[model samples]
Target: MTDETLHLRRLRSPIGRIEVVGDGRAVTSLAIERDGMLPHDGEDESGDPVLDRAVAQLEEYFAGTRHDFDVPVDLHGTAFQRAVWEQIVQLQWGEVVSYGDLGQATGRATAGRAVGGAVGANPVPIIVPCHRVLGADGRITGYSGGEGIPTKSWLLEHEGVPHTVPASARPRATDVTAAELDLPADAPAA
Candidate 1:
């Protein structure tokens, strides 16, 4: 990382708390809290214009009053990752694209997995809109932000993007029991 000192600001959202990091001029990272913990280290500087603006825009986004972000960002990543993030940033508020489609957009039609890696490596999420990307079958394969799939699900639901949660990841019915299902008491648990 650069020797430049980073500034930080945190905001509360429906999904969880979000932390924004900046280097005076542009936003450098936006991290969503995972399990009530933020995974970034930065000085808690107040009145920082960049961080302030980013927080404002993010608040507007969560409030549903803003559909796009104009706050400047300083993304640090490999060339391929940059290319993927660039394309992702162009997606409209409700638009969705598959990893394969994103890979093809970056002129690497067969690099869906690689594209996923780049997408995961994105430092700024909502601003860069990496949550807009999905699996080839419009399913949420995974998410590297906040509480993982649940966090991504919240964002997708907010944007009204149609996506499917894998059966394994879907919440199981907790109120049902052997008696409710009229099954034998000795039957194997579901």
Candidate 2:
């Protein structure tokens, strides 16, 4: 065996809370916190240098200083799942693509359902841009961020993607600009 161990970190952001899991050298997962996402205890490798580095990189991403992640993520799942996640990483920073569009992008145009399933199972959330995926009618759909559709809305707003929502439903994270958030909006600070 490679003696690999998982590392993790928790981050609180204006969009809500997030949990990141890494494999020492690269981030493997980035999950948005929902009400039921409690801290897990086992080998709380939260303080590991590799995990800390991943957290720092994530912070830079949130600040808009980074656009691409440069860590070796150990994605776990089926080939279809990997394909879906890989396509997500190719999404433009401020662009949104529907599930059908994602299917087409992945060369699985007829596999829209499978694409949705893969997106739902995305291990890395924000970094993978899973939030960029939407409904065929341009509506926000699911998000692993716990808030589900609302999290998708928040992420779209954060990326400057135009979306329809009730006035009261606007994302609060929008109050802060990319600069205020310390993000560059053009590239990654990592």
Model 2, 1-190: lDDT tens digits are 1225556777656566667776666677677756646344343545467667666776776666666666667788998789888878888778777899878877889997799899999887877888888887777655656567666776676577876754544444424345544455664421
The numbered model that scores best in TM-score is 1
Residue-by-residue lDDT tens digits, candidate 1, 133-163: 9987888988898878877877887788888
- CA lDDT, every prediction? 0.81, 0.69
Itemize residue pairs with steric clashes in candidate 1: none
Q: What's the residue-level lDDT of 165 in candidate 1?
A: 84
Best by lDDT: 1
TM-score of each: 0.84, 0.77
TM-score of 1: 0.84
